[model samples]
Target: MSERQQAEAGRVRLASALSASGALTSEWVEAYQAVPRDWFVPDLIWPGRADGVRQEESAHRLADPARWWEAVYSDIPLTTQWDDGEHTGNGRGTTPTSSNSMPTMVFSMLAALNPQDGHRVLEIGTGTGWNAALLSHQVGDGNVVTVEVDQESAAAAKYRLAQAKCAPRIVVGDGAKGCPDGAPFDRVIATCSVRRVPYEWVAQARPGAVIVVPWAPEYGGEAVVRLTVGEDGTASGRFVGSSAFMRLRRQRAERPNSLAYLSGPWPADGVRSTTTLSPEDVGGWLAMFAVGARVPDAFPLVERYADGSYTLWLHDTAVTSWSTVDWEPGRTSYEVVQSGPRSLWDEVAAAHYWWRDQGHPGFERFGLTVTPEGETVWLDSPAT
Candidate 1:
């Protein structure tokens, strides 16, 4: 088929799928149809797997038009920039820095934002400007402002937005600080994820304004939170759904390697034990979120062996504690070794059990309340 024919066919198929999935709601359907994702996507791209954790080989529009169009029209995200635009060549970089987010995530977050006509909206990440374009279409160009940390990305997005005739104010700066000049916004949305919702965003928004952001704890797992700014200058709301966006640049965690926490070789001054709880139990996304919410300031890393067994290493941000749990096939219990002040495994197990006792609630059951003092993740209600 011709390129135009391919584009139309793919667009129709994707729109149908998204509509069936209930992500592409009627309100945003016009914007979705008008703002083609290809206009913002670059020539060379790395398509992410449907699982959202891995990337496939690069697809270039010039070299492989069919694959490029397929990826653009697919629901999955496409990684456009890697390692803050430092890494070169066709191979994947150490990290995916910028991406055209998956269509489901984009539209779902937009639906959660639910901006009205003429409502001033502030967008945190302008990865490829597709989201900014869509927002512009929904709520006029003059009322939208998008902040991007990467200058190169900001320039590219600006060009794309201009070409699409959707001109939202694009600010090249720290997205965490937000655009204070455009303060008193009616709505705020962040394409990037944050460990803490920057108070600047809350401060800039008017009372009763809504802030939709992908929030993740230090340990792992993440979800998009739909918070309403209260008269008291706080934002509180439940997690709308699961999400896996890139961390906001400024809020990205400084995770030390396991070697940094070791005082000696091998076990490294560790005490060993065993637990009835399997390592696999605490490794799922939701499980990690539950554990991370209660545990605080700790993260996990996995070291897999050729035999398919793996060691789950837990480390605190302070580097004062470390723990390891071994998992192999058909193991009822796992070996555990912990060192330093905090008993990491015990904390994780306790948190996991607490979640289980609470009926293993999904993201919707959990809520976050961000106050001037701090943020709290609560189950069922904030009082808890």
Candidate 2:
């Protein structure tokens, strides 16, 4: 089939899938159809999954138009830039810095924004300009302010927007700071995930404005949080659904090498222990989120071996403590080593226990309350 015909067919399939899944609502249907994802996607891209974490190798349209076209319309994300556009060659980069997000996530977030015909929207991370184009179509170009930190990406998106004849105000600046010139915005949405909901965003938005963003804890689980700003300068809301997007550039975590934790040879200054809770028990995304919420300030890294065994390293952000759990396939108990004042493994286990006892609440049960003091997460209600 021709590229145009393929794109049209893909759109139909995508729209059907999204509609059946309830992500592509009637309110945003016109905008979704109007903004063809192909118009905003670049030729060279890395096709990734819906989770937004892993990517297959590069797929270039010029070299293989069929593969590139297939990737663009599929339900998965398309990584457009890597390592802030610093990496070389056609292969994958060390990190996925920017992307044309998955179609489902894009429309889901737009639906969460609950856009009105004339509502002024402040959008963070204008990676592909497709989202901005959709917003421009929904609420008028003048009412959409899209911010991107990377100059080259912002420029490219601007060119694409120009080609599409949907020119939203694209600002090349820190998205966390938001576009204050477009103050009192009716809605705020972020394409990138954030560890902390930036207070500056709250300050700029009008009361009762909805801010939809992908929020994650330091330990590594993410979800889309819908917060409604209050008159008292507080924004609180429940996590609408699970989501995974690249971290907001400035909010990205500082993950040091595992060697940094070890001062000397193997198990140096470490206390050895064993646990009935297997490493396999605490590996999935939900388990990570549950444990991360209780045990903040630490992150996990895994090192795999050829023998199907792996070591899960737990490190504190302070660089003061570290622990390791060795998991072999079918092992009932795992070998653990700890060093420093805080027993990272014990803390994790306790957090896991706490979560399990709480009935393993899903993302929706978790709510965030962001006030002048700080952010606090609660189960069901803030009082809890």
What lDDT does the true structure give each of the candidates?
0.93, 0.91
lDDT of 1 by residue, 324-368 (tens): 999999999889999999999989999999999999999999999
Model 1 stretches astray by more than 4 angstroms: none
Q: What TM-score quantifies how close candidate 2 is to the native fold?
A: 0.97
TM-scores of the candidates in the order shown: 0.98, 0.97
Error of 2 at 284 (Å): 1.0
lDDT tens string, model 2, 143-171? 99999999999999999999999989999
Candidate 1, lDDT over the whole model:
0.93
- Looking at candidate 2, the ten consecutive residues that score lowest on lDDT are 48-57
